[model samples]
Target chain A: MLEAISDWLQSTWLSHAFISQGLWAWPMSESLHFMGLCLLVGSVGLIDLRMLGMARGISVAALHKLVPFGVGGYLVNVLTGSLFVIGDADQYIFNDAFRVKMLFMLIAGLNVLFFYSSAFQKTKLLGPDDSMPLNVKIMAGVSLTCWIVIISAGRLITFYRP
Target chain B: MEALFIWIETSPLSLWVRGESGWHMAFPIIIVFHALGMGFLVGVALAINGRVLGLAPQVPLGKLRQFLPVAMLALVVNVISGILLLIGYPTKALTNPVFYIKLLCIALALWNLRWFSYSVLTNPIYDHGVLPQKTRQLATASIVLWASAIIAGRLLAYTYNNMMSI
Candidate 1:
């Protein structure tokens, strides 16, 4: 059954269209993906660092303004990313590099969710700069690590082009 | 410079970089570094720029400055590795219009970054503990430039015209 499904997917007209048109679309999507990543990293990093008390001088409320850009970045990533998968489904499905990259992406996404749902709630929007709790700091550290892993995993995918 | 590129291509490291290593081995390792480099430079830069724009309202403006060192370090790593990769296939990248676009994006990103540092981020406004309105403008521009640069870089693989140039 699995082989049959794979065979069907490989021969699907949708897949053929994407691959043929992807000559231009793929690059365009890739460009957008990178841009989105930049957005995610930039705003998210600032907020995370604030949790670590990096800028004791600035008001937390002001920093929160950047979160929207981070969200915007994620939106861009999702849109561009789906194109790549649709264009070359199998390249990611069975590829080890792609597998690892996906793993990192999951971890990063979960890390953000965890931060927002739990730590962020506790930390409040604009808490005192020097008073951030240790848990929040830990959360920030985890987010940073997850992002790093995601980036590395993404780069490795190219080299591991299966 | 051309001779240097030729010589580096002959180096053992370059040989390995260019060699077709078995999957799940050397190739993935290099790719990991490349991705990390991208995240470091583009990812971190964007994050920092967001802060300048007033994203993390709670964080002190001064604290956001610290990330610059990290971003700079990431850019340095990318340049070195990127050069090595270029040596591995000088003709492929040099001949590509997409590659030139990527480089131009990077140049613009860096140049804009410098402007961000001087005009907005490191300016006296942060020292005064005030979120001057001007910082917001700078932050917005930074986000745009950095994001565009990343897009350009990603498009390089798809847009190259040929494998050889000159």
Candidate 2:
């Protein structure tokens, strides 16, 4: 069951060390989390906006160069987020907000997948100022909405604690 | 100042912000706004700083200016939501030294944003991504100041001496 996994995660050395780091640990991780969020949003959101036809005269190929930063940010969040759950598994596993947040993250991930697989070829070929096709724009919208919901759900986690 | 804190803390709107009739919606929603705004504002700033430091050179620096408006919009949203949250717990925030540090960092960060806007973003000279030395330095400072602001803001919850009219 989920409880067993939570127990096992908490028993791990990483979680033990994380929790033992005293009061500042949580805030420090949170600060890092916020920074990582900036990186992800800044890079990924830029691409989305470009695909949505907001920042014209910028080629998708050029803006896509920032993908590494977004990936880096995503990794940072995953690691820090794991620490949160590992350090206090019960805080997240049974939490509806956390569940919702995870769902949003999954959707965002899938949205990106679908884009690169289907839309990226056509969109990337478009000129600097050319508008994206309607389908591509829909994906861009979905990406933005998913991220917004993910953020809101994250904020709601503490409040929605069960 | 103490009286002002007390008054702000007791206002009907402030009470609602803290939460009302078990709604508990206002505070968390405001915080979400704060988070979303921070993501865009700080995130876009980071991207710009990266470009100045030679991260993404193909994108014309001037073309990047279009994104600044979104960051500005984020700033506006945060300012409004931040005020709402402050009104909710004036004593908790105002009485804290870290709060002032956060404010200072934000002010300086905004100053850096303005400098970057005029000096680098608006200047067609750097359009090809070849930034001046000073512009690069300012971009570095922007990153540091923003990180400091976020750190100071995060630390506020732990560093505050008084939660309310103690």
lDDT of 2 by residue, A1-162 (tens): 998998898899998899999898889999998898899899998898888889898998888889899999889999899889999998899999999999999999898899889988877778888888899889999998998899889878988877
Q: What's the interface RMS deviation of candidate 1?
A: 3.1
When just chain B is superposed on the true chain B, each candidate scores a TM-score of 0.76, 0.95
Per-residue error (Å), model 2, residue B122: 1.6
Error of 1 at B74 (Å): 1.2
The parts of candidate 2 lying over 4 Å away from their true place are none
Q: Which has the greatest DockQ?
A: 2
DockQ of each: 0.57, 0.87
Expressed as tens digits, the lDDT of each residue in A14-133 for candidate 1 is 667777883677777676776666666666765676677665655445666677877887888877666566556666666776787688778777877887788665566544545677
**Per-residue accuracy of model 1 over B31-148 as CA lDDT, tens digit each:** 5566666766776666655555544544554556677776888788778778767766676677667677778767877887777666566664564344667666666775676656
Q: Which regions of candidate 1 fall more than 4 Å away from where they truly are? A: A1-14, A59-61, A125-128, B1-6, B20-27, B47-63, B126-148, B161-166
Residue A130 CA error for candidate 1 (Å)?
2.0
